[model samples]
Target: MTTSASDKQKSTEPVTKTENSETVTKYSRLPETKNSPVRRNNRRPQKSFQGSNVSGPIFQYFMTGDDAQVATTPTKKRPSLGSLSDVGSSFDGELPEQSPRKMTICEAIDEKFSPVNYSACSFTSIGLSPVKHDKDGTVRVPWTLVLEDRNIAFAGDSDTLCKYCGNVRDLDLSHNDLQSWSEIVKILKEMPHLEQLNLGQNKRLSLSYDFSTLVQSQYTNGEQSKAEKPLSNDSPSTESCPGSEVNDPQTEHDVQKKPPVSLPLTLPSAEGLRGHRDDFVHTSLKTLVLINTGAPMDTIAQMLPRLPSLEELHLSLNGYKQIENSVMKIVEPHSRVKTLYFTDNHFSDWRDFAKLGHIFPKTKNLYLACNQLPCIDISFEGVFTSLESLHLGGNKLDSWDCLDRLNELQSLKSLRIHDIPFYANYDPDPTIRRSLCIARLKNVSHLNGSAVSPDNRIDAERFLIRHYLDHHPKPQRYFELVDKYGQLEKLGEVDLSPIEQICLQLHCSEMEICKEIQVKPSITVLQLKTCVSEIIGIGLKDFNLFYKDAMMEEAFGPVGCFSELKLMSIQLSTAGLCDQSELHARTISRHHNAQRQPSR
Candidate 1:
C-alpha cells in the first residue's frame, strides 16, 4: 500500500515553500483537479492509522501560488471535543453525511450581521469591518466588536480562526454568558490594540481558584502528542503493525526514566492565567468596564497591578457595599485611572470616599450616585481636589454642610446633589436652593444636571446674601454680603433649616393636628409663611403668624420692621377660625376682617 516519490509527484498538487513556510510532509496529496483523466484501477485508497485532524482553509490552507514545483499536503476530520472516546475506532461503513455543514466562527459572526437573520443567535451592536472572504464562507478579520448580551460562548483558537490577532481596539461583551475569566483572557490576548473592554453583567465570570488543573492538562497533552507522532520516513518500522515498538526494552526504560512532571509550587499573578506558554505582559487596554461582574476582592487585587495602563474603570451596579482599606490600597499603584464609575454602590461612610480617593488618585470624573452616605465631614474634603465632576445624587446626605464641602474641590465644575434629605425636608423653593448651591460652589458650571448661567449665579448670590442676613441677624453679615455681591438684584426667600430643627405650627383645613415646623433658622417669618402657603396652597391673606399662640403680637411684627422671631411657641392660625381647636393663641381678628399678612 506504500506509494513511492514518483507516484507522489504525479498525484499531488505542486508545493511552494517560502522563508516563513512551515514544514509539511511532501507525501501528502490533494484532491483530484477537474481536468485530470480518471484512472481505471480497481485498487482502493490506503487508509493510514493516523488520527483525524481538522485542517485549514480555516487552519490548514495551502494559499501559496508558487512557481517552484515541490509537493502538496492533505487534511482530515477532527477529534471530539472535551473527551476523546472511540478516538481510533474503525468506521468501515460509509460515514454519515456531514450534517448541513455547521458554520465557522467567522461565518457565524458574519451571518449574525447578515440582513437575512438566518443565524440562530441573539446579540446587539456588533460592529464589524469587512476585510476579505475565505473559501470556507467566513468573513475577513474585523478590528472591533460589541458582543453585549450575546448568548455565545468563547470560540476555540481553531474555531472562527481570525488571521489577525492584534487589530482589535475596543470590545464590549457586557451582559453575555462568558462564564469564565480564563475564557476572557484567551479572548483579550488575541486583541492587542484593545483600549476599552466592557465585561459588565457577565455574572458568572470569576477568577480561577488555581491553575494546577490547567497546567496538568497541558502536561498530559504534550506527552500524548509526543507518543503518537510518527517515526521518520527514512527509518521505516521493522514490525508489521504500527505502534509495535511498545514491547522494546529501550522504549519501556525511557518511559520509566522520565521524571514525574508537575507545575510550579505557586504561580505569579495573571501569569497563572490560562495560556501560560506566552509571556503575560499586556497593558494595551486603557479602559476596563466591570459593572456587576461580581469579581471578588482578591481577584480585583490581583488584576489591578497587572493593568497599569488602565485610564478608566467602571464598577457600577456591583453591589459593593463595602471595600476594605487593604483592598483599596491594592489599586493605588494604578493611578493612571482618570475616570471612575462607582454608581449604585452601598458606600455608607465618608471613609469610603477617602479610600476611593487613594485608589483612583488621578480620577477627574467620579460618579457616587445611589450610595448610603449619611454625612460628610470637612476633614476628608481635601482628598478630592482632583475631581472635576461629582455625582452624589440618590444619597442620604442630610445637611448643606456636605454641599459646602464642594467648594473644597478646586477642579469641580459640575455637581449633582439631588434627592438629598436636608434640602428635601426644609428648602421649599428649588430655584432658590439651586441658586444657593451655585453661589456656594462658585466655580461649578452645572448643578443638578442644569447649566448654571450668569443670571442664575447672580440670583443665587442674592438668595445667599438674604439667607445670610436673615439667618444670622448680624449687621456684620449684611455688610459682608453687600460688599461681596454688590446689591443682589432680587432675592428669592425659602424657609430652609440652616443648621438644626425649628418648630412652627400650621392650621390647615385638610389636617387635624398641627405639627412642629422644619426650616432653616436663617429663614425669615415672611419666608416661613410663604413656604407654608405655597406647600399647603392656603390663601396668604387668611393665615396669621403669631407668637405664644395668644395671637397678641404678630410674629416678626408683620415682617421687616423686626428681626427674625424667637418664638417660644410659634403659632400659625387661620383668622376667624372656630373654637374647636384649643391652642395658647387666641383668634382676635373679627369675622369681617382678614388676618395680618407678613411681608419680607
Candidate 2:
C-alpha cells in the first residue's frame, strides 16, 4: 500500500492497506477518515490542557485524503461526573469538591421530630422505637424530646431549634457523640425554659470549660439574645419599686462602659436569661441526670456553679471512689442542691458521705443505694442536719453502731436500710428487721416507706426491749424505751410442744343435741367435717362449719379445708353466718370446761 505525500512528509510510521479492507498488517496505521487532518503517532503529547475544563474526547482530527488512521496509544477515559441536579451553580467539574454528610443537631431533631413522622399518638425516628403519648394522659403536651442514641455531634444553629423546640422543658441526649461543653451549651442556650436534662452514657463528654467565658463569647458575637439595654433618660418611666437601681451618675457611666457588668441585671425574665449567666449559672434547669458519663469530681465541681438552680443531681454509676478534697473548697456555690442520688457507685467510706453533706448542706433527701459503704462514721451524724430521708439499701454496713448514728439525724423522717449485712445476716426476717429500725430511730415516722403507727411503735419498742434484754452492752434506745415503758418484765418462755389431741364441743341448737368429740392433732378441718357429718346424719355440703370463740364471743365460718382443727376454739351455731375470714380460731387452754348438755 502507498500513503499520501502529506502522510509521508508528516511521519515515518508504517502504513499497510489490503484490497479487501484497508487495514494495517502489523504495527502500521489504518486508513484514516476523510475529515481527519490531525497527525497521530505513538509519541505522547506535551501540550498542556488550558481551557474551561469541559471534558470530551481526547483526540480530534480533520482528514483530507484516504480513510487511513495511525496507531495511537490508549488513554483512560475520565470518569463522568455524576448527576449534579442538587448542586445549584458553584460546583464545576474542575475542583472535584465534596460536601460532608455529617448530621447536625438541628437536622437530627427535625428529621426525627417532624410532623410527618408523627402518627395519631406516637412518633418514630431512625435507630429507635416509636415514642407514644395520649391526648388526655399524663403527657398533655410534647414538651419533652428524647434524642438518645441519635449519633448527633455538631450543634448547627439555635434559630432552627427555636423554631421547633422553643417550648421544650425536658431533653434526653443520652449515648450521643457530643464531645465538649460548648456544643451542649449551644443547644441548651436556645431552650429558655428547659427544666430537666439527661446526658447519660455519652462518651468523651466534658463540662470543665470556663462557662463564664463561653457565655461572654456567645453574647459578644450576638449569637445569644442581646441583654436588655438599660432604660434611656428619654424613655418613659414606671413607678419605682424598693431596692430598684438608683440612677447615680457615676454608676450609670460605669454600667455604660462595662457591658459585662450589666448583663446579669438585664436578664430579669426567663426568656431573657436563656441559660446565659455571667457567673456560670442556669436558672431554669432543676434536675440533671449524668449517669455513667464518666465525669470526675473536678468536672462535677466545675459544672455545679453552672447549674445553680439544680435541685436533683443524679451522679450514679460513675464509679466514683471518693469525694475529692477539692470539692470542700468549691462547696459555697453548689450547696443549695436539695436531693442527690449517688447510687450504684463505688464509694465505700462514710467520710465521703460526710463530705457530701458538707458540699450540699441543704440536701433534704439522699439516695446512696447499691454502693459499697461498709459502715457509718460519727462524722456523718452531725453533717446531714437537714436531711429528711436516707436510703442505704444494698450496702456493706454490718454494725449496729451505724443504726445508732443514723438515729442522730433529728430531722430524718424516713429511712431505708435494706439488703445490708447487719439485717441480711443477723435478722433475716424483713418484719423483725423493720421493727428493729423503727424502734432504733426515735424521730423516724416511716421505715422503708411504711408509716409507723402508735401501736406499731409500742410493739416495736417492746420487741426491741426484749430483743436486747439479756445481751451485754445493749443499744441506747433500749434504755430510753425501758424508761418510758417502765422496765417491762422479760417475756415468759413460749411453750412450743405440739399437741397430741384436742377436745372439741359440737352443738346444734335447732336439734337440741350436744356432743363432745376428741380428735388427733393431725386432723384437718375437712376430716373433722366428715366426722361431724356422720354424727349429724347430714351431707358435707348441706351445712357449713363454724367455730365461735368462747372468750372473745366472735363467730367465724367458712374455715379453710386444709386448716388444722387441733388449735381451733370450737363453739356451735345452727343458723348460717356470713364470711368471717379475718377472725382466726385460737387454741383454748385445757383448764376451760365446755358447757356439756345435761342428762336427758
* TM-score of every model versus the real structure: 0.51, 0.55
State in Å the error of residue 259, model 1: 9.6
lDDT of 1 by residue, 1-600 (tens): 998888867766434454456433433334354654333332322221121121112222212322222222333333232222222122347653321222222333433343222222111222332444455443344567665544433433422333333466777777655545555555565565778888888776544323323334444423522212222221123221111222458856776676766555433455344345543336788988888877765566556655768888888887787877656544434578788999998889887787778767778999999989887774645576678899999999987766666667788998898788988887698876776677777689988779988888777667777677546453343454588867654455687833344455555444343654565555455666677666555565654543342243354453323222334233322232222322221223455464444546
Winner by lDDT: 2
Q: Candidate 2: list runs displaced more than 4 Å.
A: 1-102, 115-142, 206-280, 333-335, 493-498, 502-600
Per-residue lDDT of candidate 2, residues 323-367 (tens digit): 878766654445669999999999988888888877788899999
Residue 520 accuracy (lDDT) in model 2 = 68
Which candidate's TM-score is highest?
Answer: 2
Predicted structure 1, TM vs. truth: 0.51
